[model samples]
Target: MLYSIWRYRHFILASIRGDLKGRFARSRLGAFWFILHPLAQSLIFSIVLAEVMRTRMPNIDSQAAYPIYLLSGMAAWGLFSEILTRSIGIFIEQASAMKKIAFPRLCLPVIVWGSALINHVLLLLAIAVIFLFFGHYPGFAWLYLIPGMLLISIMAFGIGVFLGILNVFARDVAQFMTVFLQLWFWFTPIVYLKSVVPEKFQFLIGLNPMTPLVGLYQDALLFNQRPEWMNLWPAIVVGFVAVVVSFMVFRRASPELVDAL
Candidate 1:
């Protein structure tokens, strides 16, 4: 782990700059669009659902600021989903560089995930501004969100690296991930709350690694409450296990990645 981390530092640094520039190189708005995309989505969804459709999902409290609640959940979900989706093509997309330069294969996924996380942090800053304007103070409990965000990022990176390597061999992996992420998003609590789920279904929801993650963000940032540690601990354990397994899989497959490409 240490060796890979050390070897990949340059790739990480380069990828960050490359990814950022590649994303906005041709665009007039450049990096501003990164912040604008999420903010615009949050605003449009919040207004359309809360006003036009009046579509209030069952789990969240009726009196609660629904937009704030929804955006908090969406912020975490968006980062994970975006990273996983983009990481699917990392190796294939960077095949030229991979053949010419020997670098840690793991850095591919890390860079993709890191770029998306930077966008998420920007959105969180926007969320903080909105909260302040509304006279809602998140208090010290908001610190709990950092661990939750880290766990989500780790899980996303692990899964992304694993799938990324597989996608090198299987052209269908990216297509499958598209559908998988869509299903996973709805299965998660982004559009609904855990309390609204039926008792029997609640256990199943808890089994989802993303459940506790989204719950943690909403609890800490929106409700100004500490994360439910008992529930969160299981997700953290699962995330760590996922990371170890993914590392082994990616390492084992690294030798064949270029060949597969």
Candidate 2:
């Protein structure tokens, strides 16, 4: 599958280009809208929550720090959740193409990841600029964003492909994910500080794999601290397993998917 995808590398890039161009084809701002929409959201949310949670961060001493914290987490969560959400409907969206095409089916999820990564790049760039505008430069700690986003993206892609395969067979899987994501968001601590999550309920947050990943982003981007590497290993192991399992599932199910559609 790896070799096959490489064989058609140009096709994948073209598909990504076409997908992006079509997405922005009708809008005046086009791709800028992607960055603006999320930028505006982070700015608005930060303004609202800064006073409430500004002091939660120990490394940063200013109220303006809240959006930096928030957007850092969003940078990670947005890539993850967007890929997962889009994965649910991907097979269905390309059902006709699946039936007719002889290309690798794995490319479908890759396309999703690639597309989300494009948007993620924009968001990260926006976040960096915002940090600069606020006089909060990241320095050396900022480099963590690359590997941090990679690990998160790989893990998210694994979950997405697994869910996508399931959604293909059970249409309800797609519908259920919509509601599942809403609940998942509050649980992940995107807008607020985890320190504010009460001790009694902290165990619930600990059980969430995303908790540590998002924390990694927050520590690196918001506080300019090294990520809690001790806590990150377990999540990395889970991501590896998920990627392996997803590949096995996709390989076994690909031939049958065309029939199902």
Query: RMSD of candidate 2 to the true fold?
Result: 1.4
Please report how far candidate 1 places residue 173 from its true position, in Å.
Answer: 1.4
lDDT of 1 by residue, 58-164 (tens): 44444437777778888888888888777878889989988999777777777887788787887788788878776677688778878877888888877787788
Model 2 TM-score (2 dp): 0.95
Write down the lDDT of every candidate, Cα atoms only: 0.79, 0.85
Question: What RMSD, rounded to one decimal, does every model reach?
Answer: 2.7, 1.4
Q: Which stretches of candidate 2 lie over 4 Å from their true place?
A: none
Point out the worst 10-residue segment of candidate 2 by lDDT. Answer: 55-64
Candidate 2 lDDT by residue in tens digits, 153-206: 888889889989999899999899889888888998889888889999999888
- TM-score for candidate 1, please give it: 0.89
TM-score of each: 0.89, 0.95
Model 1 per-residue lDDT at 57: 45
The model with the greatest lDDT is 2
